[model samples]
Target: MKDTQPADRGAAPTTPAPAVVTGKDAGRVAFAAFVGTALEWYDYFLFGTAAAIVFNTLYFTTFDPATATLAAFATFGVGFAARPIGAVVFGWLGDRIGRRPALLVTVVLIGVSTGLIGLLPGYASIGIAAPLLLVLLRLLQGTAVGGEWGGAVTLAVEHAPPGLRGRYAALPQVGSPVGTLLSSGAFALVLLLPKDDFESWGWRVPFLLAFPMMLVALYIRRRVEESPLFDELLKQDERAKIPALEVFRSAWRPLLVAMASALLGVGGFYLLTTFVISYGADTLGLSRGLMVNATLVAAVVEVGVILVVGRISERLGPGRVTLWGGLASAACAFPVFWLIDTRSPVAIVFSIAVGIAVLSVAYAVSGALLTELFPARLRYSGVALAYNLAGALTGFLPAAATALLKVSGNASWPVALLLVGLSLLTALGGFLGERMRVKDPVATG
Candidate 1:
């Protein structure tokens, strides 16, 4: 049979399709997505903070002092190495049974794994086993995040009303900044403890905090119904039984575009947010608390600007906004680091905040745009793989940038060029994806 599906197999249905969200239900969907994603991101950002500040000293001290830090960062990146498996496993479940169940599983996995990290014995206590167990936990965390992002995005994008998809979709992206704020705040407080206590036991507080937050997120998620689009899909018998298999077979074009579209945005953010912490603390001799505060400020700006860009995308189209945002990111690439070099508190916050703002423009609209790349039957698998594929690489971004800096005699130019290149790639992929969407009538909604 001819492929009657949207171009690149990514566009919305050509027909009027199904309308699953009403006014009240729409808000509920977005809120549920936000809460769940916030929990996941809290876990993610917490680990990143720990890796940058404490993990090397605590868990990987077998290596030379400098090597321990790199090892710690490498372990952090290793977490992403497991995400592709997660995308496949959870993606299959989401496509088959339901999005809600799959997402529920992801949250539980992340919460349990994260909490256990608090209880794990450090290298001083457990020797080789310490880092070994830490690696295992990070792998689990990566998998959970791998599954969480795509399913959470669906909850908002698929439920959105026409002309409002941009803003509604952006709601889930809000969770990252919220997560960043909470994680940084938690660590900032922990740092206030006496040095011995903070080193010995205080670092565990943030990881333990996930347990309670997870319960709250779980309760809210359980109450929220599954995606309206998936329900319509069920009624139509269009759900793919082996969506992971089908997506690879029929959706490679859109999948390629999706991967490219997600790459720079995800990687650049990690380089900016996570790696910046290490660079500021270890290289620049900046106070850890000060860098954390700067990152917190950036997160705050990200939240506000993401909301605004979501609205702007409603009129200008996500592709245009996203492309421009990428250009904006390229522009800020060197400035952000230059501000850090100056080590001026006010300038640091402005630089990082502006950097995050530019990043969010593409991020805020990514869910809607990526979702449009696949038909509903296989969307879970398609989006999951696409997003986590980016995760697979992005997780290593900080380590890569760190190594580049070291190799270049601590020059920031290599890192800056990497940022600019990734931004341009994002622009190119988004522009092409947008063109495909516009050519397909059903995807316009």
Candidate 2:
């Protein structure tokens, strides 16, 4: 008998026009992707907050406090370092199999690893093995998240109509704040327990809670179809066999520009969201509840700013808006420290909220701009590699900057200003990227 059955590779790709995704279709897809990304980030930010607050004690307490904290942050950076690997591996699968399937696997991996952390025995319970397991699990979580952002953004952008792609894709990007809000809120709530109660048991509750949420994300994702763009690529027989290498060979310049651009607000994101929480508690003598509350305020403000800046990009263009926003972020870095130093609760809240708002301009435009940088064959691989590399560079920044502050005799203002200077460089890269030619028929080279 002749071989009649189609290959068992995966589901048939669907091809929908990128510029014709109706408002209703875009809304449904974007919402699903948004929730999915939000859930992914929730696991990540939750761990970041925990690492800053408790991991050193729970996993590394045997060493001197400074060494323990440094070790904890080193482990934290390890996850970021693992991201590019995930991007390459998962990006290939996404380009080969489809976006939905690749993302489904990533979300589950992250949820499982995060939930398992809650059940891990601490150093006292398991001796030296405890921290080792924590580091291993963290690497898993990092790898999973490294895959999440690229796939989520691809889904939203590929499904969006051309004119509104910038705004449509931004919905999922905004989910970062929604995730941050939930993660910070959970941590803050848990902090209300007595110190002994918290250290003994309460810390696990927030992580355990991520399981049910993950199930919900999985269900929502399953109902969504693959991107129409990928489908069209299949119909045209345009799939690249080796996407990662192709991206490096063909789209290297855009990839570099995208990486530098990504470094802008993400560094600010860690500083305001992760570092500041620890700083408030340890350096400023703020209560745990108060510090977390300030972070929550920032998250809420972050979501709002995402909406405003995303819409603004639709009008002014992603490049111009992001450039201006980056400059504004650089300008405010010094005053942000001043606000925090006031030792007033209101000042702390204002500082974080303002910082998030300024960062939104760059954050809102990034997904769409990066997605538009390459042909669809290498889109997943190209965008994922660039995005993850930038994240890896900046992932440990908060911890490093904090250490610098201490080493420099608490020269808080200058250290903070140095972060702003980095933001200026990010802005410059993004501006250059904006001048590149817009690729036509985005699904094929």
The global C-alpha lDDT for each of the candidates, from Candidate 1 onward, is 0.83, 0.81
Quote each prediction's TM-score.
Answer: 0.94, 0.93
Clashes of 1: 3
RMSD of 1: 3.3
In terms of lDDT, the best-performing candidate is: 1
lDDT of 1 by residue, 1-445 (tens): 1124432245454432454466667788888999999999999889899999999899988787678888888999987888888899999888778899998999999999999999999988879999999999999999998889889887777777767878888888899999999999999999999989998999999999989998999999998888777776666555666787777887888888888788766888888888988888888888899888988998999899889988888898777777887888888899888887897878877888888788778887888778778776677889889888888877888888888978998888889899898888888778877865522122323
Candidate 2: worst-modelled 10 consecutive residues by lDDT: 1-10
Error of 2 at 113 (Å): 0.6
Model 2 clash pairs?
14-231, 15-232, 16-228, 19-162
Off-target runs (Cα >4 Å) in candidate 1 are: 1-19, 438-445
Question: Model 2, range 316-427, lDDT digits (tens) per residue?
Answer: 7777777888898898888988898887999988988898788777888888778877667677887789889988988887779678867876567755776687679778
Top-scoring candidate (TM-score): 1
TM-score of 2: 0.93
